[model samples]
Target: MKKNGNREEFNREKLLKGIVRSAEKRPVSMDAITNLVDRVENKLRSLGENEVSSQQIGEYVMEDLVNLDEIAYIRFASVYRQFKDMSVFYKELKEIMEKDKKKNQDQDHSGDK
Candidate 1:
């Protein structure tokens, strides 16, 4: 895996540890995490490349977490993004809230049809 222009061996255990840590105190299940890891591996394999970037893997993890559990997503994002201040955290929360609100609105509109 290439992280910040440095090539290194892909470490699945390290990836799992980060995921597990983020899910601590959250309701995300171990099975869910396993499935997510499997999916990420499949994606990487499908790309037909031996080298992948940490950012790419991080994006995949974030995508999975966002769909699986909001709290877990935030937890993972905080560490992945290295949030520096409350403002950054607040902004991330706001983006999630807005997206949720929009989704709810779309559902409401659909129900009216």
Candidate 2:
């Protein structure tokens, strides 16, 4: 079992629940979610620590979801980051857009003959 900063036993079920909720109405499959959970568990083991922060776990989830589904990634991020207001939400969305834009630009430049 993992422990959070608060020194409480981390609930793995809660992690799965959050992923499930984020994937709701999205194209993410149950198999993918299961695989993600396994990956996160492996990550925790790889850390070889007695306790791990919720923030760290959330980061791993966000990284996995970002590649699995953008919508699900945003959904999980909004909740995990606990956005205080629309401004925060907007900022996150803008950052994601900018990252995608830059990635596309780099790809386009690389493809140029």
Candidate with the greatest TM-score versus the true structure: 1
CA lDDT of each candidate? 0.89, 0.87
TM-scores of the models, in the order given: 0.88, 0.84
List, residue by residue over 9-107, the lDDT tens digit for candidate 2: 767788899999999999888999999999999999999998888888999999888878889999999988989999999998898889889989999
Model 2 C-alpha RMSD vs. true structure (Å) is 2.5
> In candidate 2, how many Å is residue 22 off?
0.5
Model 1 bad stretches (over 4 Å): 2-4
Q: Looking at candidate 2, what is the lDDT of residue 72?
A: 93
The residue-by-residue lDDT of candidate 1 on 1-113, one tens digit each, is: 55569888878889999999988888888999989999988888899987888989999999888888888899999989989999999999999999899989999899797
lDDT of 1: 0.89
